[model samples]
Target: MTHPGKPLIEVVNLEKDYPAGAGVLQALRGVSLSIAEGEFVAIMGASGSGKSTFMNLLGCLDRPTRGSYHLDGQDVSRLSSDQLAALRNREIGFVFQGFNLLPKLSALDNVALPLMYAGTGREARRRQAQAVLERVGLGERSHHTPLQLSGGQQQRVAIARALVTHPRIIFADEPTGNLDSETSRQVMDFFSQLNREEGITLVLVTHEADIAAYARRRIRFQDGRVVEDVAQAEVAA
Candidate 1:
């Protein structure tokens, strides 16, 4: 049950620190932002700029050293590890550059993995996974293993896997990093389509300006701080 025109993700004075040698390294310095529902945003920075660390915190893969994070109006920063895991399973989807698929599993099964984790029955999982695969234009490759599919097709399968959960938001980490220019465009186009048609919030982390250009909003990080956050004109999908 999604409510339009609401801030789907909100963070205040967010910070993270990691142990480095005898001291600590600050990865995020009082970062604060909100992502409205259905907005597509890209985070960009150089190496060690803390963009990845910010993404990790936003994705709930890591806990912040300080600050509050609210997802879907719930204070996720206070959730326990098990509760965080459950929340992630139900509310978030992820796409990665590596296409982290099981080598032996068919695309259908890989896409169905999340549903299986949520205790979905075999028949229901199959039905939902197939529907998403078809939506991603991979219906014909449903039975193929990751090793047998092209890089783009495998990424599409990964997209289907992310979509199968009907998540509130999707986080993509360098999702087009390994693809060629044309393939990258295709992937970005598909991401935009999803945001437009399904109203799925998207937060992408990438170092390339070209890749970031696909997003409607861009946030740039430098030295663990967001130095720039701006909205760009929409590009035709």
Candidate 2:
């Protein structure tokens, strides 16, 4: 069952800027958003709309330039890099467009890497990795390397790796960018199942309309700000 009234993510007056040749480019303009526990949301925008910056912030890959970010009731804006890394390892799971699987390692090893980094015992890590791989429908492919699997299978392995740690939330950035429509649908279905069954919050970043459709809510960004926040009923028809 989904946890009630738990605010998994909260961003207040967040901003990000980059130093250009002669001027500073503002990527995020004081954007604020709140994501509840077990909610499935998608952030959508064009190439320069700051959605990518938002994703980086949401995944704890980068800190905001100004303002505060609270993740799971902890103030994350003030954390040091190492501290943030530790928090990310324990709280956030990431799925990327390219799968990001180690080319030479088997799927099981790749999935077990995070557990190893967290100092879990070898046998325990293997067991947890195997369980997650099975959940993602890749248990039979656990012995295969990235080069040995199809695109969809590789993505499933990546998803398994992300879930093995049992994070509070999963952040997926253009996760289906490299897959065909059918494969993309399969991956999205798997994500939906995770959210509904396991009560894991899912935040997806995508530019594709069909891909975003799978999310319960959609936030649209433009020129470094959110222009629209719509529920599924508002945009689905």
Candidate 3:
């Protein structure tokens, strides 16, 4: 969780472009926004609207073509790839639709992999991984592999893996895309609980209105620019 009264994310004059055949393709165009700590924000847009690009920038998976990005009050726009990766490991957690769990590893080991990279001792990492699995309601399934679990259960393991890092913010990109309606709801409920109880900042990317409804704030993008940004109260009205 981040300190109160400070923005966890701040992007100013952000822009991204890719080279096309004898031309340039703009992905993000002068986008600017501030997201406070503990805020749950949903980013919505159609394909090619720059939603993924913006998320990549925010997640430190990719750098902006030109912009200023301050994450957790640190300016990350100028950081090197190694530096950004180190910061990402320390400050951010990511969940994807694919669930990306290692096939051969048991749920427990998969969740502990990040901590292993962080150089935790064998017993300490295992304990932390088990604790996160319990937090995600997968205490009894720690020995199971991804193939042994249901789709929903696999996603829970992925969530447990993300939480094991003790990240300050979580970025979920279409996390429920591969799940059924009921499973999606269950996952969203977990996300809501994490935010409310732990003060974890959450930013979710989705195209479905129902999924976006889980977030307290919604931001829409089109043509690489924000079309609408509104709070749930205003949206409800």
Candidate 4:
């Protein structure tokens, strides 16, 4: 079912396959779902269940072998590589488990990197990056490099980088995978705040049940298909 106003994501018969030694290796098989704007969703699965594959397809990092994917009502299943890159840059922000910051750049520069490709002026980029860094509670650490920061702080920098582009949707792959329990709580809180306050759609892949608890909707995958899709109230009941 799609949401009112407009669905931020809609997928149908989504499938993905890879080349095996001779035959094909099916990664995802006939998965379909929809997500609304401002919805927070948690995707869960055991390894090889195709949760990761589904996410890759949604993020446009990889193409599906078959099936259609509509993002924000646009059929993105057939966009060119350059078009996909541009669309991703303008509409989606990504938070990785490994905090993929450029090692040589300062936090500000790293956050500003996406804007440079968009041809943003130096001052505007600086202003936007600093604002997001401050929003993530790392304004004081803006001058530090990834190596110079704590793991939790580095993750915040990565989140700031994701937000600096002013994306409407965020795809976070295990956003708290490397943090301590307390730090993970903090990060999850930040995610909830962004979704509530800014109306940003968030879809995150997380294996931890407690982390998944934060999402309003939870989806589980098994053998490359959705095993469960339920709302938080129903799940609690």
Best by lDDT: 1
Q: Assess each prediction's global lDDT (C-alpha) against the native.
A: 0.91, 0.89, 0.91, 0.90
In order of listing, the candidates' clash counts read: 0, 0, 0, 0
- By lDDT, the better pick of 1 and 3 is 1
Off by over 4 Å in 2: 1-4, 234-237
lDDT value for model 2: 0.89
Q: List model 2 lDDT by residue over 64-127, tens digit each.
A: 9998899988888888998888877878899999999999999999999989878899999999
- Alpha-carbon error at 128 in model 1, in Å? 0.8
Model 3 residue runs over 4 Å out of place are: 1-4, 233-237
- For 69-146, candidate 1 gives per-residue lDDT tens digits of 999898887889888887777889999989898889999999999998889999999999999999999998899999
Instruction: State TM-scores per candidate.
Output: 0.96, 0.95, 0.95, 0.96
For model 4 the local lDDT of residue 51 reads: 92
Tell me, by TM-score, which candidate is best: 1
The local lDDT score (0 to 100) that residue 118 gets in candidate 4 is: 76
How well does candidate 3 score on lDDT at residue 141? 94
lDDT of 4 by residue, 1-237 (tens): 334337889999999999999999888989988999988899999989999999888998888888899998888978999889987788989999999999999999999999997789999999999999999999999999999999999999999998888899999999899999999988998998898789999998999999999888899999989999987731231
Q: Candidates 1 and 4: which is better by TM-score?
A: 1
Residues 1-237, candidate 3, lDDT per residue (tens digit)?
233448999999999999999999999998999899989899999999999999999999988889899997888888999889887777888899999999999999999998987889999999999999999999999999999999999999999988998998999999999999999989999999898889899999999999999888899999999999988731231
